[model samples]
Target: MFELLGIPPQVLFGQLLLGLINGAFYATLSLGLALIFGLLNIINFTHGAQYMMGAFVAYLLLNLLGIGYWPSLFLAPILVGLVGIVLEKTMLSRLYKLDHLYGLLLTFGLALLIEGAFRQMYGVSGLPYPIPDVLKGGQNLGFMFLPNYRAWVVVASLLICFATWFLIERTKLGSYLRAATENPALVQAFGINVPRMITLTYGFGVALAGFAGVLAAPIYSVNPLMGSNLIVVVFAVVVIGGMGSILGAILTGFGLGLVEGLTKVFYPEASNTVIFIIMAIVLVLKPAGLFGRAR
Candidate 1:
């Protein structure tokens, strides 16, 4: 077999594919964070917990209700999103005029509370979610084998990310949303319900997180702390991408995921820390991030 960098092509390509898969999840989750922070100005520490909730909800639907994965993908996000809307109306909205730290602290507390509640019930053991029957196989691309479900994840995540970007950047409704974010008072003066728009935007962002959770369920073990494990890395991706920059978040998430994957192949020990190291470098050189604009 031909080799690159003295590594087998299979190993090299396999790791690259694995990197892309991880990138899909990172992109999806970070995109949600960017949306919430950019439009709502909320740090949203509870996002990880919301992600955990999506997986749990899907698990419950499948085992308890026999709903299966296909339906759970859509249903889980909607259900979790409704909960997010309630959180915005009942609690998050009040902090809009306050310091960003306040929103961060509140969401952080909520994350702990939610995680604690799930851990109490589910314990720390992870649960398996079987891949759907239709997506159970793999394809050999000569150099590497690609699992069907993993391919689906990459395609689905990229499509959703693009759709979200287009919605926010190239549509009429998106213009309204951007307008409200920039100057809510003026938007409201023109007869738009700014508060409601903000609430829905938050819900949509939470839904994106929930959607990512469903995609992750079959790939990773489902557990209360599942989100806890990945959220930090995702936050790093958001920071490196420039928080609140949609395009930046999408591109950066995938880019870092590939970087992490390759690091694992070349230097196993550094793979875990590579993303953070890049983050630190980005911070020192450009505090605003690679894609973020300084205010």
Candidate 2:
């Protein structure tokens, strides 16, 4: 068998698998950001904070309330989503009529506030989340061993990305939401509650971030700054995939992850900046992004 980029097949495949796992996260996170920007027209800087909150929320529920991963998986997102809803209603909603920069700044401050509060409480230490028993094994895949939990993460992320795409592209409620995104006044004139829809949309977008956080809790350490650096990469993925299309966001996320993984095998030094380099290339070649339609 030809070694991939002169690396051993085993090492190559392992990194690729890990890359796909990280890509799963990128897909989910970027998808949430894309949904928020695509519909709300707001660059949500608080997204990373919200993702961190979801992981922290699960940790707290597990330690303080005796809740486990299974329950927290659903509860954490809903709880964080409520927090998002409150933000939209009280602050984000007020910025809809203003320039997009205002919303971005507001969310940037909000991210700082959230991360600071959590860092103060948790002290920047990583908390471990126990994996559920049902998802705790591994399968031998000849070349690489596949952990059940990581596999679940990829599958779950894909299911979510697909389901969201379906809902947005094929559903009646999605039609209304898209219409509201395009023109709230016209949507409201048609008897739809556009403001409420916006609130729910923001909530839902952050909820997806929360869901990714929950899935990530078991694999990565749950920490206040967990999403800090990760968010930058996710933003790059969004730019490459294009905020104009959720499917584009999802595809770019996973694709870049694989690319990153491959790069790690051949040129370890470039692992960190590969995605951004790709983003720069995309910006130069296609400002609208891979899947984004030209404005």
Candidate 3:
């Protein structure tokens, strides 16, 4: 087998693939965070809870209604997005004029409420979600065994991330969203329903989290506590990526995941802390993040 830097190609590629899979989740979650922060100026602490809710919702659909993975992929996000819209209209709207910290506190409370309710019902044990029949196998790519579903996830996430980036950064509706984020009053004066837009944007961001949960359901055991573990690292990803740039969030997410994977290969002890360490270094070197603009 070919070798690079004293490592076999197989090992290197395999780790890289795993890194990309992890990156897909990080990118999706961070993209949602970036969108919410950009529009609402609030860190959505309930995001992880929403993600957990998505997996649970899928499980419910399967058990009660006989819905499968493919359907849940669409339905879970819609249901979760609706929940987000309700939260925004009923609770989050009231916090708009207050300090951003108020929004954070409100969402943090909401996260606890959500997680607590689920824990009460489901407990902390993980539930298995069967992979769809079609995507349940792996392919030999000569150098490594690549799982079909994993490859699909990486491609789908990249497409979704770039599509979101293009929509927000290139389209007219995106222009309105950006404008509303900058100055809602002015956007409202221009005949835009700024409040409604904010609500939908929040829903959309939450929906992205839901979509990720669906993708993750088959890969990891579904548990009330799964999102809790992942969200902290994702938050660090957001901080390192910077809040102002959507692309920055996507890039940082994938980059950090790969770095973490590499660390696992070379220095197993540092895998968990590598991302945070990188965040500290980034803060010291460029407080605005790699792709972030100094504000």
Q: Could you tell me the C-alpha RMSD of candidate 2 in Å?
A: 1.2
Rank the models by lDDT, top first: 3, 1, 2
- lDDT against the true structure, each candidate: 0.91, 0.90, 0.91
Off by over 4 Å in 3: none
RMSD (CA, angstroms), candidate 3: 1.3
Every model's TM-score: 0.98, 0.97, 0.97
Q: What is the alpha-carbon lDDT of model 2 when measured against the actual structure?
A: 0.90
lDDT of 3 at 35: 95
With candidate 1 superimposed using the best TM-score fit, by how many Å does residue 252's alpha carbon deviate from the native?
0.5
Model 2, residue 196: what's the lDDT? Answer: 84
For residues 42-101, could you state the per-residue lDDT of candidate 2 as single tens digits?
888998999999998999999999999989989999999999999999999988888999
Q: Give me candidate 2's TM-score against the actual structure.
A: 0.97
Instruction: Provide the global lDDT of candidate 3 against the true structure.
Output: 0.91
Supply the TM-score for candidate 3: 0.97
The digit string of per-residue lDDT tens for model 1 on 99-191 reads: 888999999999999999999999999998999999999999888889999999999899999999999999999999988878888999999
* lDDT: worst 10-residue window of model 3: 1-10
- Candidate 3, residue 142: CA error in Å? 1.5
